[model samples]
Target: MHAKPSYTEAQLIELLKLKNQRAYNYLYDNYSAAIYGVICKVVGDEDEAADVMQEAFIRIWRNIEQYNADKGRLFTWMLNVARNLAIDYIRSAQSRKSSKTESLTESTPLGAPGYTDAIKIDHVGLNAVLDKLTVEQKKIIDMAYFQGYTQEEIAEELDMPLGTVKTRARAALMKLKHLFV
Candidate 1:
């Protein structure tokens, strides 16, 4: 759906190899949007996508010298750079977010005598919303979020398919999001 480049790509690459600023400018002018599009698709957040795009460009600029025509076009190489950076950024963000959430959960304790759980305040906040959620949703939410069970664990424990568990979890979250927001 995109138009072909007006400039010969090989010429741009040759100039790029020589470290020409104009060639870099031309490359950005012609391909920044496409690269950003790829990043946005992976990150699914505009602000984070912008950050990933900036990092991707920095990586491409530094690694341009390693690109070879025999492997593929300069454009493809640059596209890979952007996509990989975006995916890595997303994964790292998820890791950090999960760690923080676990830490918070660990600090919470179930007040029952001789019964200690990582969750402290889950009972207070989640109880109000439980009535609003479907049976399946409530079960999934309890296992995954409250009871600290993984998707695979839920599926195996309940004797259901993993895909079904995931789909149900997603639907449950959507329902809760609609209810709360």
Candidate 2:
């Protein structure tokens, strides 16, 4: 097989901005696995993850001109796109309805092999960082960041006041900051 093409980030961004198909192909070839991994973590279902992955790529291709190198790297932007799509997918009414069925199907019969997700938070030490927070703090951070819930949405979903949600989110962030430091 021919060696895959490689381009520096700058060169790839330039080519992508120029709408070069080869550059798009290279970006997908190199980054799809990482993007899919993020999507899988957010969606937790392989079929839905694959669907979200397609939507993410389409979004990236359509919005390539909107990407600003001054803000962040290409992969980071693409990851956010994929991750947001996955979160959105999970929050959709269709996903909620299907999840009811999926949950039932997901359970293994007795003696069946256990299934593990493709991505593990502990592998990247996110679990360790999260473990430092209280349950209430962790719930706020997980819903706000990982699950892509707005503070208002989280409040409504959890039946808590918006102020309480905001307070917990801020406290969670403060605790997380200490962990990084």
Candidate 3:
């Protein structure tokens, strides 16, 4: 087996900016798992997450020149891209339509051929993290992150000002950040 190529973040950035195919391949090999994790957290389904993952890499490749090292690290920018794509996927009209159809098809008649009871699986880590937040913060985080609601959508759905929603989300994330560090 061939050894994997390694590049320092700076080297990788330079190579990516040059549009080197090898650099792109190396970037994908090294970073796809972390990127996929972020996508999965937002997208929440294996199949859909896979689709968004491909789109995210394409976006990263095509938009590599737009990345500003002064703003943040490469991974952070990529995560934001993947996260935004996932949010867009969930918010899309097609996704909404599919979700509705999926729900209808997922339900089986009582005593039918392929009937199964609904499972209640607790996301312990998510719950623990959420428990640290206030009721207002929790509502915003739940809707924005787990339920895949955009901040604007959350504000509208909650009848809150968009600025207020943004403030709450920022504060909530800050608190969660403190918990880990």
Candidate 4:
């Protein structure tokens, strides 16, 4: 097997700063598959993962100047962008799914993708507030929201009493409301 050409991270950064097409090509060739794998794992949708991969690259290109070598490696910065985009995609997709379910039986025509018009809270900030909750509260909320688990399923999976699960979930939501609103 032939050996692959190697470029140092600093060199790649310099090339990227100059908007070199070859540099962009090299970056994608080396990292796109790995980044896409991460997106797929988080979003669980191949199409959405592909979209997030493209968006992450666009963001990297646009924000190249914002990267700080003193802070960490170039790959670290790229990974952070990819992860954040994937999380945002998952959250947005879930909210859309819920809204669609809610509007399905209404006599009036469903509004055209009104998710963007819904309450606009910063996801990272919300996650921070969630971090402040008790571990059990946080776990239930994550199961219910991120994993799309029903209360019954959560109770069964956690081996907790159904009423206790319901109570904790309600308490978690109330805490989130206070933290977010």
Candidate whose lDDT is highest: 2
TM-score of each: 0.52, 0.69, 0.67, 0.54
The residue pairs found clashing in candidate 3 are none
Candidate 1 lDDT, 81-171, residue by residue in tens: 8877876675577577775235323422332222223145644555567667876677676456434557887887668999999899999
TM-score ranking, high to low: 2, 3, 4, 1
Q: Which stretches of candidate 2 lie over 4 Å from their true place?
A: 1-8, 95-124, 175-181
The segments of candidate 1 whose C-alpha lies over 4 angstroms from its true place after superposition are: 1-6, 99-181
In the range 87-143, model 3's lDDT, one tens digit per residue, is 677658345576533432232111222112212232455457657878777667656
Which candidate ranks first by TM-score, i.e. highest?
2
Better by TM-score, candidate 2 or 1: 2
Cα lDDT of model 4 by residue, 87-166, tens digit: 67766775867652332222112221222322246345544774678877877865554345577878877799999998
Positional deviation of 161 in candidate 1, in angstroms?
12
Q: Identify the runs in model 4 with alpha carbons over 4 angstroms from their true place.
A: 1-5, 99-181
Q: After superposition, how far is residue 120 of candidate 3 from its true place, in Å?
A: 20
Candidate 2 lDDT (Cα, whole model)? 0.75
Instruction: In candidate 4, list every pair of residues with a backbone clash.
Output: none
TM-score of 3: 0.67
* Candidate with the larger TM-score of 3 and 4: 3
